[model samples]
Target: MPKVSSVIVPYAVYLRVYEPLAAFPEPERTHWARYARRPDLPSYQDELRRSLAGLLPTPPVAAPVQESGDAFVTEVDGVLCVCPWRTRLRGWLALAELDEELPRPVLEAALPEVVRLQAAQDHERWLESNPDARPWIRMAVWQVPLHWFVLVSDEERAYEKGTGEVAPVLRYRTPMVQARRRVARSLRTLKDSMDEGPLVEGLLDVGRWLEEFHPRSLVELDYGGLVHVLPAGDLEDDHSARDVAEGIEALRTGDGAAAGEAYARLVERWRSVRDRRSAN
Candidate 1:
């Protein structure tokens, strides 16, 4: 097995608050219109820099907006930008160089403050008027630098007045979990194919990497904006990690035939799933 070093997993917390333009009073609406303009304008970037200053320990590295309105705009490092639109204030903060153990408390504490600064008064007033709005805050965590696969999890929370806190009320999807299921299924398929090659070796490599993490490690995917566009079924996960480990172990014991068989099983399983889905 290859040595696993201390890897710095890049993580990001995406925060978004949605409110209609009509909900805002006249003066505030005008103010936002100027704030949420095209990124090419020097004034727009400056405004974001000023608003977010000192909000996070690491300042945003200025970069061009990646997309149009309502899209996530960010820099290469820890810097974050709120891509404001007529209806929403959406952005993400990249928490660079996080350890495998994700610090949930630190994230929880900083989120509200960031929202308070970025959303300004709009978030509060929206809640005041809508009162019944479900899950006022939408947050997602992204585990970065995913080369071959990705995993995504969504958490919904409600704000409490007395404590000024956001409590998680629901967590429905975990892409990583689903990926595990697929990997199990793929292993079953590979059982029949039995051809040894680079693909099998690559799967073994992934398994080795996953084995390096602590058992309780939280594996997340960085879906970013694709959460809005991609179908839940289309995303991938880290499910094959264990099986690859098993195959590698067989190879280490000098059982070339056994290693080849393991690879075959994975290949067949994945192919079957793809064919079945395509037929559907």
Candidate 2:
């Protein structure tokens, strides 16, 4: 049995693309190359700790003044792959999404109206100048999005039953081409079986996001810190991608019972993790 610890970590999952160093233009490619060779590069956990610390100020620093210089770097077959920490832009996007979803009073309590407005205007201006920009990372709170599971498989899943300050981790990494192919096939199957709904829309959005990256880039699905909130059994039994694949196949085969069963298992498993948010 995997030993569960009381380590505290953020309850967020991230989908990130690590593009090859060659995919970048000169100066950036040069910069990342040097950064990757540095001996003191921050680990993923270290970066998360620093980011959380930044939110401890009086009003809370929602975003930084400039883009982050750090990146999550990995080596693939001797080639350097860098996923830049575009925290500033990601912050703006997060705020915008929150603003749309939350009530005014609730949103303002965390982010003052003035601060929120300023960030919105800044993002608008920034968008006008850099229309081609796309985020290197996307995050979800509480539970991983079902669409994300489409890009990975059970065999690719990696688990680390972390000890001490380290929390348990679950993630998957697949080449961009495979990820895109899976998304496309899944989208077609879902659309053909059902009407236009959230699943179809979500898959379309994911497909579009994947299209913005390099053909040879690597896609990752990190459970982030949510693993800490789940029970040991849940973590051990998690084969979300496999379940998702089963559901899709069942749908294609017109097997309603099997499809419903797979969908229920996926939803109920994540629902338990999400429901902890309101527990006293």
Candidate 3:
């Protein structure tokens, strides 16, 4: 095998399941995010590195050849990405030299048991800083070449006692919201008869996002959730909501499946928003 020297990576760590922040993109995050944890290319950089440190009576993981605050330039073959309200996230850990697609379940075999053992150390540190009723560490492992993402959330005793939307993570995501609107609009035009391709493509995007997502982000995944489309709901929802209302204006004007589907999507899109608000 060829000797590997260096690579680049990015990563995230989330704590709560379906936490609202899980929906927003990282760059737009509010300034308040910094108080919780350390972030680097493959998140929990120290934990991951300490776990994988090559050899010593008690050695450090291979030092990053170079690193910045969010991305670490190293030779490790793994990466992590941060996800919202703390449920899901993704990051990159570049693996040098060994280039074939990684096998499934390689993480358990590759990372040492001590990494798992060190969990409490960070937990104590996090608790000391914020002292939330509960503290958790969710690690998302991603191996890009293999198309893999695995989640690990080490939650604390206090949180496990609770259930049902305890807290919400505020999100400010422009790109994801734009993509949601685009897809919803295309879906609204399904009856145009001009072509089915665009609408079909929109459905495809919806399916992909739905499948990979947890239930929380799905709530306000859009602009206050889905397109308004007139009498159905508020006008501020977005263009697609207005479009849906217009489409219905041209509908056979009945609550048949097509109308129902459109209306249902409007509701579904806004569900994340509604649910969170209800919880609050």
Stretches off by above 4 angstroms in model 2 are: 1-8
State the TM-score for model 1.
Answer: 0.24
Ranking by TM-score: 2, 1, 3
The regions of model 3 sitting more than 4 angstroms off are 1-194, 219-240, 252-280
Candidate 3 lDDT over 79-140, as tens digits, reads: 12233222111111222211344453563345344542343344445447645322122233
The candidate 2 region of ten consecutive residues with least summed lDDT is 1-10
lDDT of the candidates, in the order given = 0.36, 0.85, 0.32
lDDT (tens digit, per residue) of candidate 2 on 1-280 = 1122233456778999999999999899999998888876765555566566657777777677788888999987888999998888888888879867788898777778777788788889999999998889998878888989999998999988877765688999999999999998898899889998888888899999999988999999999878877876788889999999999999999999999999999988877876797782
Q: What alpha-carbon RMSD in Å does predicted model 3 have with respect to the real structure?
A: 19.4
Q: Which candidate is the best by lDDT?
A: 2
TM-score of each: 0.24, 0.93, 0.23
Best prediction by TM-score: 2
TM accuracy, model 2: 0.93
Model 3, global lDDT: 0.32
Candidate 2: C-alpha RMSD after superposition: 3.9
Q: How well does candidate 3 match the true structure in TM-score terms? A: 0.23
Residue 244, model 2: Cα distance from true site in angstroms: 0.5
Assess the local accuracy of residue 208 in candidate 3 as a C-alpha lDDT between 0 and 100.
52
